[model samples]
Structure formats: structure tokens, C-alpha cells
Target: MSLSHALLGLLIVEPRSGYELTKAFEADIGRYAWQAGHTSIYPELGKLAEAGLIEVTHEGARGSRTYAATDAGRDELRTWLLRRPQQSKVRNEDVLRMFLISALEPADAITMLRGIAQHTAAGAAELRQIRELNGPATQRGPAGFGLLAAEFGLRQFDAIHGWAQWAIEQLEATADGSQDGAAARSVG
Candidate 1:
């Protein structure tokens, strides 16, 4: 997720200090997507301000700088939202590790499968929470892209969980030599 675009979208709605933006981002979008930290946010804000995409006003006493999107910024943000985003490469470490598990003993592979199952179960729970929070907002016909995303997350987690279980069975079978109808293989 692009923190700059997310921040700009919020600022376009209303002027807010950095603290308020962080809190709102965490409360709303951050549940589904990763959020930016102070180190990244402040630098992005400075760059945006320099480029005249956002205007900053300093408030007294609190010493907080409130930012609002400029006309140009709004235009830019609109254009960005309308444009198709580039597809990112998918890099799943779990799948890669599983592909290389033949290097390890079957017992070790089973252990890894168990761990993956636990992780996938936890991920499914998180996605369920996201779905509940989003509620009807995700089911509003064509505008329910967020709902589609949440559903996708749910399915992906489910698949991962199923794959993990299958892997465990396969590893156990290999370890016991059940598939070949022979004596159990001892791990040396």
C-alpha cells in the first residue's frame, strides 16, 4: 500500500495533523493494510509539502502542523485513483520453503507443516475480523471492492490452511513408509 496516497486521500477529505492521520489510519484502513510509521510519514509529508501537493498550517500551543490537500494535490490524487495500478510480484516464502522441504527429514517437514497450519488459522481469524468490521460496506454492489478484497483474503487463508493439513499427511505418510506398503523409514 502507498502511504503517501492513503494520507493524501484522507487529507483531501479534511485537514488534519499527523497524529490524527496516524490514529485514523490505524483505526480504519490499517486493519486491512500496512500503515506507515513516523519515520516514513514525516519524510513523505515534507516531500509533499515541498512539491505544493499539500499545505501545512501551524497551530499554536500544541505546535502541531495540520495538513490539507491543495487543489493540485486533489487533482493528482483523483487521477491516481482512477488509473489502473501496476500488478506487484507475489513472493510467498512459505511455498518456497515447502518446495525445498525434501532436503529435511520427514519429521522436520511435518513440524513445519504444523507451524504453517497454525499461522494460516491465525490469518483466517484476522481476515474474519476484517470482514465483520467492513460489514455491509463491502456488499454495496459495484462499489464493494473492499468487500471483494476481504473475501479474497478469507479464501487465500483457507487454501493455505488446507494445503498445510495436506502437507502434514503427506509428510507423515513418507515418514511411516505407509504409501509404499513397507517398513517405516528411520531418520538417520
Candidate 2:
């Protein structure tokens, strides 16, 4: 995700100090979309100021400054939003581990599959809470896109959780069949 564009979007919602923006990332935006610590956010803010895409709107105690997006920033953000996104290489570590599950013993693989199911279920529950808090998903307000994003996360979590459960069942069936075969061979 583009930190600059994400910041622009947030500023479009409302003017905010650097500290407020960091809080935004930690609480909302970073949860499902972009993540930026103050180090990266501060530099990007300076660049946005240099480029006239954003301006400092207020100065508070201890040299704290609040910033708002310029008209140009809105235009830029709109253009970026309209552009077609390019396909990029996916690097999901959890998916990679699942692909290599055969490398693990059956018991270890079962444990990992169970862990995935539990984690995804918990993630889905968290997204559901976000969905409730964000309310409706109309495009007419600041909270609109957030509700949509939360819905997307909820769907993803449910799908992964379902897959993990199916995988666990497959592993258990195989284990049971192997045990039956072993018993038969010993008797013969």
C-alpha cells in the first residue's frame, strides 16, 4: 500500500496531527489496509508538504502541527483511486507453510491445521466487531469505505477458516486409514 496515498485519504476525512495520524494507522487503517509508523509517516508528510499536496493547518503545543490535504492532493488521490491496480507477487507466509505441509509429520500437520482454523475464526470475529462499529457501507460518508473493507476482511477470514477445517478432516481420515492398515498387517 502507498503510505502517501493512505495519508491523503485520511486527511481527506479530517485534518489531523502527526500523532493523530499514527493513532489512525494503529487503530483502523493498519488493521486491514496500510501500516505506517511515525518515522515513515513524518517523512511522507514533509514530502506531501513540499509537493503542495498537503499543508499544515494548525500548530499546537510542543511544535505539533496538524495537516490537511490540499485540492491537488484530493485530485491526486482520486486519480490514484481510479487507476487500474497492477498485479503483484503475493508473499503470504501462511499459504507457503500450507503448501509445504507434507514436509511435516502427520501429527504436526494436524496441529498446524487446527491452529489455522482457530486463528482464522478469531480474525473473522474481530472483523465482525469492526463491521458493527463502522455501521452501514454506503459511499456517501467517511465510514463507507471502512465498512466495505471490514466486510472484505470478514469474508477472507471465513474462507480460510473453512479451508483449515476441511484440511484437518482429510488428515484425520488418512491417519485412521493408516492405523487400520497397520493393525491388519500385524494380524496377517
Candidate 3:
């Protein structure tokens, strides 16, 4: 989804300063989905305001301005949410690197795959910690949605870790030059 839509969605809950929105994205929203940096977020807020989607509702110290979604903004956000989802383009550096492992030695590929598994496991653990910290919030309605996303993140990491381990085992078998190695090579 576009940053504008995401920002507008966040503002629907309550008016918040740009700093507050940045923290929300990093602390909650970024955990499971998109992450928009402060630089990007502030600019998007400006654009949303220019489009009459959001407006300054409160001003605080250091030029901080709180923004709330305007009626036009709410309408735009609702329309976008209701529309058919277009094909999403994913850009994962880790996956891209994994795909290029054919250029590396088998041992090196195995090492990389093992690292991927380790990293994924660590990430899953981190998500678990976040979930535990938000226990009460997860039991409620709006907050429960965040918990659901966290659960999905956990599942995704589990799958990635499992696949990495399986790949490592397959490579090890190939290196042994066993009959199964021939089958594995043929399948691959």
C-alpha cells in the first residue's frame, strides 16, 4: 500500500504528530509490513495535506504539528481500501541473494543458507517478545489486528527457517555423491 493510505489509516484512529506516526510505524506497523522512514513520512504527510486528505489539528514544541484525516481523506482511504488489490511487487534482498547462490561453491551456499535460518529464528524470537509485551492489547479489537499481523510474521519466519534447513541438508547430501544426490540434482 502507498504511504499516503497507510498514514491516513493511522490518523483515523487519532490525530498524531509526525514524530508519533514515525514511532507507530517502527514500533508496530513496521514489525509486520511496510516501513516508512521519518524522511519519507514527513514528506508524505505534506503531500496528504496538500491533497486535502489530512490537516494540522494541533501544534506543539519544536514545530511539531499533529495531523488528522479530513473527510476527503477518509473518503479517499475508504475507496482505496475497498478497491481490488493490485499485484504487489516484493523486493526482498535476502531472497534475491539466495536465488544467486548457484554462482557460489556448495559449501559457501550451505553457510549462507544456515545464516538465513539463524537470522529468521532470531527474528521470530523478537516477534514473540513483542507479542508478549502487548498481551493485553492483543486481546482487544483494533489492537488485536496488530497481534494477528505479528502471528503471521511468526509463521512466515518459521517457514523461511524450515526451508533453509531443508536446503542445507539437500546440499550436504549432494556433496556426499550418494544415489539420492543424483535424484536431488535432477529435481533441482
Candidate 4:
């Protein structure tokens, strides 16, 4: 999804200062969906205002401007959300790394896989804590919807952790087979 789309969606839920939105993205939305830096966000906000998609609703200290989506922005956001996306996707870094992992030495790959398993397990555990802290979602608003996304992320972590461990097992079995062959050759 486009950065503009994310900004509009966040604003639709509630008006927020640029600083607030930045923090929101840092902790929540950016983690689950799109990501943007403050530099990009400020400029995007300006562009949205110029396009009449958003407007400054409040002025805070240090020239911070709070933005809210206009009706046009809401319509645009809805249209974009409803539109079916093409099959193409932005490649994930982890997936790219996994694809390239075959280039690594077998031992190194095993080490990397172990790291992946550990990292994902930690992430999943953290998300579980968040889920417990959140209790349950009662509505489909930001808090509730965000919790849904967090759950999806938690599942993804679990799946990746399982896959990494399986890959390590496959590599270890290959090593074991190679060692047995080496010993057989020495005996012969």
C-alpha cells in the first residue's frame, strides 16, 4: 500500500498531529503494514493537504500540525481499499534472505537458521504478551483491528520459527550422511 493511503487511513480513524502519527507508525501500523519515516510523513501530509485529501485540524507547539481526512480523502481511501490488488508484491527482506541462504556454507546456514528460530520465538512471545495485555477486542476500530493484525504477525512468527527449525534439521541430516560416508571411505 502507498504511504498516502496509510496516512489517510490513520487520519480517518481520528485526527492526529504529525508527531502522534509518527509514533503510531513506529509502534503499530508500520510494524504490521507499510512503514515510513518522519521525513516522508511530513511531506506526504503537505501533499495530502495540497490535494485537499487532508487538512490541518489543530496546530500544536513547534509548528506541529494535526491532520484529518477530508470527505474526498475518505472516498479515495475507501476506493483504494476496495480495489483488488494485482498479484505482484513488494518482496520481504526475510524471504529474500531465505532464498539466498543456499549460497551460504552448510554450517553457516544452519547457524543462520538457528538465529531465525530464536528471533522469531522471541517476537512471538512478545506479541503474546501484548495480546494478553490487550485482553480482547470488542469492536473493529483501531485498537481492535490492530490487535487482529498483531495476531497475524504472531502466527507468521510461529510459522517461520517452525520452518527454520525444520530447515536446520534437514541440513543436520545431510551433514550426518556425509560424515557416515567419510568414515566408510576411511574403513575401506
Candidate 5:
């Protein structure tokens, strides 16, 4: 989800102010996936402007500038979409931290499991809300693809919740067994 490429795609659709592009990103793509902050987006736009991939026009409306993709930008975008993109490396800090927690006491691990369960539940709730907001009506006709993606997100969230519950139960059982074994050893 490179901000530069996304900005190019948006410009391809039509000329837009930076504010409008940000709004569209947050509402559509950023809602489900790919987060782009103003820092990244603005800088990318500047670079694109410098490269002549996009041009800016000032209409003297509160001194705001609008941007549109140039022919070079369109060609670049086409090349980008058609070419094979490098696979991005996934770095899940939470998952990595959880793996490291094996060094902690069993109780601490169980506590982490509880936190994960809570997070997953919250994510599921958010996904449900997104699905409700973007119902079948939103998907009808031209928006059908977006609607399908929203449904996929909902399903993914549900799966996450289910897996989280199962994981928590398993971790709790393991922690209990470990504690029981420790007690038996002390008694022996």
C-alpha cells in the first residue's frame, strides 16, 4: 500500500485536492486496509510533482492547490499495475512479542492470551460495524467489488475472533496444567 501508487491511482480517476484524496483514502481503502498518514501522502505528492508525474494547479480558492496526473504519471501507473510487484514482508509486532513471551512466567503468558482475546473481540466488533454500514445496497452495481471486499473483511474478523477464543482456552489449559504440575512437585 504505497502512498505514491495510491495517489497516482486517485489522480488517474480525476483531479483532486489533497484533502479530497485523503478523505477518499480514509473512507474507501484505508477503512479496510492500507493506512496513509498526511506525512507520507503529502511528501509523496511533492515528489511526484517534482518528477513531472503529476501537476498542480492553483485556482486561488483559499490558496488551495489541486493535483492531476500527467501523461507520464498515467504511464507510470499503468506500468506499475501491469508489472509484478515485490512481495511485502509482514512484520506483526504483536505476534512477534507473543512469541518472545515464552520466556515469561506461565501466568504472564496467560495474561497475554487474555489481552489478545480482548483485542480480537474488539476487531470483530469493528468489522461487524463496517459491514453493517456498507451493506448490499452499497455493493450494488459499480460498488459491488468494494462490497465483496467488505464481506471478506467481516469473515476474516470472525475467523480471528474464533481463533483467538480457541487460543486463549488452550493457553489457559496449559497454564493450569503447568501450575498443577508445580504443586505436585512441591507436595512430592
Candidate 6:
């Protein structure tokens, strides 16, 4: 989804300063869904204000402005949410690099795949920790929808981590010449 829609959706939950909004993205959806930084978010908040989609609800110290979604913003977000989204173009750099693994020697490829397995495992652990910390409270409120998305992300990481571990084992077997090209045969 576009950052604008994301901002509007978050504002609908409660009024928040730009810093708080940035933190929400960093700690929540930004981790698994979309990525945005404070620099990007502040400007989008301004645009939303200019378009009458959101309004400043309060001002805090150091010019910190809290914002909430306007009625118009809520309507806009609801409309966008109900419509079918355009198919997203996948752009995962890690997966793309996987496509180039054959260009490396088998030992190097094995190393790279092992690294992926480690990374995926770490991501899954972090998501699990987040769920443990926040799931119960969030699942009981209007925010419960977030639990569903978080579960999906956790599952995705689980699946990827499992596959990565399996691939690493297959590579190790091949390295020891115990599988007689089992990895290649499996792909074919």
C-alpha cells in the first residue's frame, strides 16, 4: 500500500505525533510489510494535512505535532481498503541474489545460503518476540486485525527459514559428495 494510505490508517487508530507514527511503522508494519523513515513520513503527514485527509490534533514540545485522520481521510482510507489492490511487483534483493548463486563456486554458494538461513531464523525469532509481547493486548481490541497480518509474516519467515535450512543441508551433502548431485537432480 502507499505510504499515504498507511498514514491515514494509523491516524484512524489514534492521534500521534510524527515521531510516534514513525515508531509505529518501525516497530510494526514497517518491519515486515512496508518500510518508511521519519524523513519520508513527515512530508507525507504534511501532504495529508494539506489535502484535508488528516489534521493536527495537538502540538507537543519542540513543535511536535500530533495528527488524527479527518472524516475525509477515513472515507478515503476505507475506499482504498475495499478496492482490490494492484498486483505488487516483487523486488526482494535477497531472493534476486539467490538467482545468481550458481555464478559462485559451490562452497561460496553454500556459505551464502547458510547466511540466508541464519538471517531468516533471526527474523522469525524477532517476530515471535514481538507477538509474545504485543499479541494478547492487540488481539482483543480494534487493533486485532494487526494480529492476522503479523501471523502471516511469522509464517512466511518460518517457511523461508525451513527451506533455507533444508537447502543448506542439501548443499553440505553435495559438498561431501554423499548425494551424487542430489541438489541438481531435485531441481530438475
Highest-TM-score candidate: 2
Model 3 deviation from native, Cα RMSD in Å: 3.7
Which 10 residues in a row give candidate 2 its minimum summed lDDT?
A: 178-187
Per-residue CA lDDT of candidate 3, range 46-161, in tens? 99999999999999888999999999999999999899987778887977887898899999999999898999999899888878977844475445547767888888999999
How does each model score on TM-score? Answer: 0.67, 0.84, 0.79, 0.83, 0.67, 0.78
What's the C-alpha lDDT at position 123 in model 5?
Answer: 70
- lDDT comparing candidate 4 with the true structure: 0.87
Q: What lDDT tens digits, residue by residue, belong to model 1 across residues 1-188?
A: 47888878778767888887777657636775666667777788888899899999766457789999999899889999899877788677867897798898878878887888898899889878877866754354323435666777778889989988876766677676685532223321
Q: Which prediction has more favorable lDDT, 1 or 6? A: 6
**Better candidate number, 3 or 4, judged by lDDT:** 4
**What are the RMSD figures for all models against the true structure?**
6.3, 5.8, 3.7, 5.7, 6.5, 3.5
| Full-model lDDT, candidate 6 | 0.83
Which scores higher on lDDT, 2 or 5? 2
* lDDT of candidate 6 over 60-149, digit per residue (tens): 889999999999999999999999877778877978887887798888888887887788788888778867866563454345647767
Output the worst ten-in-a-row residue range by lDDT, candidate 4: 178-187
Which segments of model 6 are wrong by more than 4 Å? 60-63, 136-146, 178-188
Cα-based RMSD of candidate 6: 3.5
Better of 2 and 4 by TM-score: 2
Clashing pairs in 1: none
Error of 4 at 120 (Å): 0.7
By lDDT, the better pick of 1 and 5 is: 1
Pairs with steric clashes in candidate 6:
none
The sequence of per-residue lDDT tens digits that candidate 4 reaches over residues 136-171 is 756566666577777888999999998898788778
